[model samples]
Target: MAVPTVPRLGPQIGTRLMRRFSSCPRAYSYADTLPNLKIGAHTRVLFQGFTGRQATANVKESLEWGTKIVGGVKPGVEGEHLGLPIFPSVKVAQEKAKPDASAIYVPGNQTADAIEEAIEAEIPLVVAVAEHVPIHDILRIHSMLQTQSKTRLVGANCPGIISAIGKCRIGFQPLPCFAPGHVGIVAKSGTLSYETVASTTRAGLGQSLCISMGGDVLAGTNFVDALKVFEHDDDTQGIIIVGEIGGAAEMDAAEWIKDYRRRTTDPKPIMALIGGLEAPTGRVMGHAGAWTAPGEPDAQTKYRALEQAGVVMVNHPEKFGHGMRTLLARSLSKSGTSNTLFGNGLQKRGYHATRRTTLASIVGYQQKRSLYLKEAQALEILKLKSVPVAEGDIGSNGLICISIDRSALSPCIVASSDPESDPRLLRRIPFSYGQATVENHPMMADLADQLKIPSSSRDQLGSIVQALWEIFKEKEAFVLECQIGVSADGTFAAHGARFGFDDAAYRSSGRQEEIHRLRNTSEEVPEEVEAEKYGIVYVKLQGQGSIGTLVNGAGLAMNTVDALTFHGGHCANFLDTGGKATSETVKASFQIICSDPRVKAIFVNIFGGLTRCDMIAEGIILAFRDLHMQVPVVVRLRGTNEELGQQMIAESGLPLHAFDSFEDAAKKVISLAGPQ
Candidate 1:
C-alpha cells in the first residue's frame, strides 16, 4: 500500500492560489517581469542571518562567484562581515541595502522567522535553504506568502536557485556541473539538478537558469511556477526537469507542456528524469518529499505523463546527460529545427548500446538485394588526470584523502588513509562554518615543534596549504587535492595533483584559457553526484486498493496501512500532513483523497499531539463545503483538543462520522469501502 508524503500537487495548489489571492488576484499572477521566480546576474541578493557562520561562508562564496550581494541582516550586529554592511532587521536592511532578493541561511527552527521577515520587508524573491523545517510552520507561512504580492519564496528546505548563464548563484549549487546555454532546469532533487546540467552541458547544451525546488513536503515555488518563468525567459530554448516519485506536480507540469505546445508556434524542447524508481516503500528516504503518497502519481506514471506531453525522457540517472544529447540529435535530424518532438523513435536511450544478436536487414521492394547494417561503436575507457577530481594530498600528508561532510549541517573535514575507506584510520575534524582558515585548518599543523615535523617541511606544507586554500576559494572547487613530493634536501614540490573545481568558475575566473589548457572537460558524469534532500517514502500499490488513509507522521502512516490491510481493508493512498497540520493542509488532503476513484471511503486517524483536532475538524467542514464529496469519511480523533474537535464535528451536522473507538472507525470505513 502506497502511504503518504505531503507535497502540494499542482492542481490542488492552484486552487489554493486562486482563493488566497482572490482579493487582488492579478498581483500574484505571472507577469512579464516574473518578479519573484525569475532572477539574473543583475539580481541583488540579501543574506539573512548575515553575522551567522553559515551565512558568512555562503556570502563569501557568493561574492567571490560574482553574485551581486548588496548587504545582509543579522539582529544585534550592525557592523560588517566580508565588507558587506549588516543590519538588525530585514526592514532596516531593505531600506539601507535595497536588495532585490533575500537568501536565508538560518536553522530549520528559525527558518519561519527568517522567511516572515523577508516577506514583511517585501523582498521580491526570498530563498530559504534550511532543511527539516516544521511542516505546520510552512503551511502557516506559505499562507502568509500568498496574501502578499511582493515576495516569492524558493525554499525552506531547498538548494535555492541559480542563474548559470549569468554567473549568479544564491544557494550552493555546484558550479562545475553547469555551463551557460539555452536549457533551463527546475528540479526537486539537488543532485539530479546537477545530473540534468551534466547531461545537457556535455551535449554542448548548457543551462540558462536552474531552480532547485527543495525536497520538503512543501516548497514556496514548484515545477509549474519555474516553467512559466522559463516560458517567459527569452534566453532559454529548452528545459529539463528532475523530479522524484512524490506528488502530482509532474503531471501538472505535463499539462502545462501540452498547453505550451498548443499555444505557441514554436515551443522549447523539454527533457525530464524522475528518480527513486527502485526505492522501497513507506518511510522517510533521503528527502521529505521524495516518496509517493496516496492519490499521488508514481514514478513510472510520471515518466509516461511527461513523454505524452512531448517531453524527451531520460530513462536512467546514468543515462541522463548522454541520453539527452542522443535524443536531441535524433530529434534535430528529423525535425530540422529545435522544435523537437521525440515521437515514434521515442524509446529508452540504450538501443545501440544494448547487447543484441541480430543486425537490421533492409530488403528492397523487388527483393533483389539485401543491405545489412551492423554497429561500430567506440570502446574506450575514461583516463585519469583528464578528470579534475582531487586525489589525496600525496606528500607529507601521507596519501590522505580529505572530504567535507555536512550531515550535521556544519563543515566537518573527514580524513582517511584510503579515499574509499573500509577498516582504516579515519579522523573527523568539525569546525564552525566560517572558522576554517589556512592557519587553523584541521589538517594544517599549528606548531611545527608539536607535531615533531621538521620546520622546513612544515613551512613548505603550510605554503602548500595556503596555496591550495587560495586556489580553492578562487576556483570555487567542491573537491581539490594536491600531491606534494619532498626530497632529502627538504625541498617540496607539487607533483601530479588532482583538481576538481566548478565548470562555471573557469569561465569567469579569468583563468579559463589556463584551466582549459590543463584538461578538456572531465569525464565526470554529474549523475553520479549524490541525490539531494527529499521527503517521505511510499510504494504505490498497483492492484485494487480502496481505503484512503489520512494520517499524521510517516512512522504511523505505515502502521495505519498495515492495520487496515490486516483488517481486510486496502488503502488507496497515504497522506502525511506532518505532526502539525493546519486546516489548509487538512482540506488539501481531503481534496487529494476525494479525487481518487478507488477510495470509496476515507479513514482519518489523528493523534493530534502537535496537530490540533480542531483544525482537522475545520478542514473537514471546509472540504465538505468545497469538495462536495460522494464518499463517506470516518473520523477517529485522539490526544490534544479531541473534545473540542468532536463538539465542533457534532455541531456541524456534516456527513463526517466521529468515532471514539478505533475498532468502530475501522469497521465503519472497511464496511463502506467493501460495498459498491
Candidate 2:
C-alpha cells in the first residue's frame, strides 16, 4: 500500500466543475455545484429483461462503447450470460452489483412492471425503450415516480439518453452519430435527434448529451425537463430542441425559456427545429404523439413562438447543425469565448468556406415575380362573363378588391385565373387562396350552391370545380372572386365566371373541349374532394358517432376524437376554430358542429396561445344563447386567461359542463352521450 498509492479522480472532476463555473456561474446553482449525476463511464448500469433480444443487443453494443454494464435482471434466468450476472430481481442484483441506473428492455406489456421494480430498487435513473406501452400504464408509472421524487425516468417509448463525453449509452441511440462537445440535444423524436446529432457533428459541433424524450402522447420526460437539466449541466454550452407536431411541450418550453432568459444574466443560447411543416392537418405522422390538433400549435406556430422567445429557429431539419453552429459562434463571440474549436471542428469535418452567408440567404430565397392580371382587367372579365361582381375598386397592384361575404363562406376556397391568355388554359387556374370565413359573403353562397349541385348530383364536384377553375387562367382577365362551399352541405358557388379568353381562341386551342370533357366525365369523389366539400379542418372517419368535436387546433381536435374513440365513443364531425378564434368564428364553428344531426353531444376543447380563452368562452356563451344549443356541450379551456374564461362560462348560466382538463371534459361528454 505504501509502495503504490491509488491515483484520485477528484482533481479531474474538480477541474471539469471549475471550468464549467468559469464559463457561467448560473450553469451550476449553489445546491448543484457538485458534478451532475449522469450516465457516464464510472456509472454502473443494470439491464431489465437482460435475456431479451433488444436488451442483449443493446448491452453488447454498450459494452463495446466501454459502458460499465454491471449486471442484468430477468426472472427465472439467474445464470451468467454475456459474461454478466443475471439475477431473478433488481433487489437481488443490487446487493451483488450496485447499479446507478437501469435500462428497461421488457415488452411494453411488462415495461411498467420492470420500471416499478427499478424504482423499488431505488435506481436513480431508469431509461425505458419499450414502445407501444399502454398509455394508462405509463400514467401509473409516472404517478409512481411522482411519489418517489428521487427517481428519474427517461422514456416509455423513447430511444434513451446518451452522454458523448462520458462515452456511455443507456438506450438504443446510434453511437456513430454523436461526438463529445458542448451542444446538448433534446428531442421528442429519436430518428430526428439522430439526424440532428449527425448534422451537428458534420458542422464541427459536438454534443454534451442527447436525450430522446419519447414519442408517446404521455412521455415520462418532456422538453422542459431535459432543458432544465442541460441548463445546469456544466458540460453543455448550448441546447437544441427538435420538436414536431402535436402537444404543447414545445410551446411550454418556449415560455419557460422566455422566463429563464429574463431571470438569468448568462443565459445559454438555444435553437429549435420544428418538424412537420408539410404535414397535413389531423393526420398522425410517425410518432404516436406527433399529431397536430386544431388550434394547437403547428410548425409555424411553434417556430414563431420559439423565435419570439429569443430562440434561433431553423426552418429545415437538415440545417439544424448549421443553425446551431452559427448560433454557437455568435453566442461564444458575444461571451468573449474563443471560437477556435468551432473552426477546428469544421475544418476536421472537411468543411471549407471562404465566406459565410446570412441564414436568410442560405435557407430561403426571394419569391419570383408572379404573372399579374390587373384588378380592373379581372373586373371587366367578370362583367363580360355574366358573373355577379361586388362593387369594389382595385389596389395599385393586380390583387382583387371586393366586399368578401364571410358568413356564406363558413369555409371557402378563393382562387384567381387569367380569363384571356389561352396557353394551357386549364393549368393556369391558381387555386392558392383558401380559408375558413368568419362571416357570410354572397360569393360564398353562390360557390356553395355550385358545389352542392355537383356533390348531390353526380358527386363529380371535383371535375366541375376544376372545369370552372380553368376560367381564371385565361389571359390578362382575372376571376376576382371564386368561392367553393366547405359547409356540411356540399355546394359550389362562384361570384365570377370566365369566357375562356377569346371564345374562338379557346375553342381553336382545343382546351374548351377538354374542359367540357373533364366536367362531363363522372369520377368517384376522392377523400380530398369530400374534405373540401365540408370545411372540416380535420376528420377521422370511423363511419359512426353521435358526438362531434369543435376544437381550437387540429392537434387538439384529433386528441379529442381519439379520447372519445378510446372511451367507446364516436365522433360525428371535426370542426377546428383555427388560429383566429373570435366570438363570431367560435359561434359559427359551434353551429357547424351542432348542425350535424348525428352529433348529439359536442366536445369543445380550446388551448389558447394566440387565441384568447376568454374570447373562445365568450363565443361559446353567445353561440348557445343565440342558437339555443340543443346538444350536450362539454367545454375544456386552458391557457391565456383560462380562469376568466371559465368564470364567464359559469356566469352565462348555460347548460354546459366546464372542466380544466380535456380528459375530464371528454369523459363527461362521452358519459352524457352514452356509448356510440
> Which residue segments of model 1 deviate by more than 4 Å?
1-33, 323-676
Please state the error at residue 141 of candidate 1 in Å. Answer: 0.8
Deviation (Å) of 663 in candidate 1: 51
lDDT of 1 by residue, 566-619 (tens): 456777765555545566666667766666677788998765543467877888
Question: Which candidate achieves the best lDDT against the true structure?
Answer: 1
Candidate 2 lDDT, tens digit per residue, 1-676? 0111111112212343223222332232222211223567777899988988868888898899888899898886689889999999988988889888889988777787787777667677788987656443454454344333446777877878889989888998767667888889898766556556766887888899888778765666678777888888899988989877766688889999989988988788887666654344444443445553212345556656776788765433345577677767767677532323233121111111122232111111110101123334444544554433443322111111121111111112332223222212212111111211212323433343422333353233333343333343333111123322223332222332222121221222333344233221123223222332333344434466788777654434544454455455677765555434677766666666665667778888776543567888888898888988888888877655778888888788888888875446767888887755
Error of 1 at 361 (Å): 46
- RMSD of model 1, in Å? 27.4
**How does each model score on TM-score?**
0.48, 0.47
Deviating ranges (above 4 Å) for candidate 2: 1-37, 293-295, 335-676
